[model samples]
Target: MSLKITDECINCDVCEPECPNGAISQGPDIYVIDPNMCTECVGHYDTPQCMEVCPVDCIITGVEESREVLEERYRIISGQKVA
Candidate 1:
C-alpha cells in the first residue's frame, strides 16, 4: 500500500526529503503522496522513510496492494525491467 499524508500532518517539511522515490510533495493543504510513484521504499529501504521521520504520525497506508505489486513498482521506478 502507498502511504498517504493525512490532515493531521503538521507540514513540518520532514517527510518530503525522506521519501526515496520522490513521491511525497506539498499539496494545497498538506503533503501528498503520489500513488504511482510510491513503493513504500520496497526496494530502497526496509521501511518507508517518510513514515519513519514523520513526527506527527500522519502518514497512513493507502489502498491495499500485495508486496509483489509494491516490489514491481519499485523496480519500475528504479528503471529495472520486470523479470
Candidate 2:
C-alpha cells in the first residue's frame, strides 16, 4: 500500500525528496501522498523511502494494496507497460 502523511507531520520538508515515485507533495496543512502514483518504492527500493526519512513518523501506510497491484501501479507510473 501507499503511505499518507498525518496531522502529526512537522512539515520538515524531508519526505518529498525521499519519495522515488514523486508521490509526496506539500498540501494545505502538511505533506500529502498521492495514492495513484505511490508504489511504496516497489520499483525503486525495498521499503518506502518517504517513511524512512520522515522525522515525525507521520508517514503511514494506507489503502492496503497487494504487492502485485503495487508493482503494476509502479510499472504504469514508470511507463514500463505497453498498451
Count of steric clashes across candidates, in order: 0, 0
Q: What is the TM-score of each candidate against the true structure?
A: 0.95, 0.93
* Model 2 worst lDDT window (10 residues): 74-83
Candidate 1 local distance difference test against the native: 0.90
What TM-score would candidate 2 get against the native?
0.93
Distance from true position, residue 72, model 1, in Å? Answer: 0.3
Highest TM-score among the candidates is held by which one?
A: 1
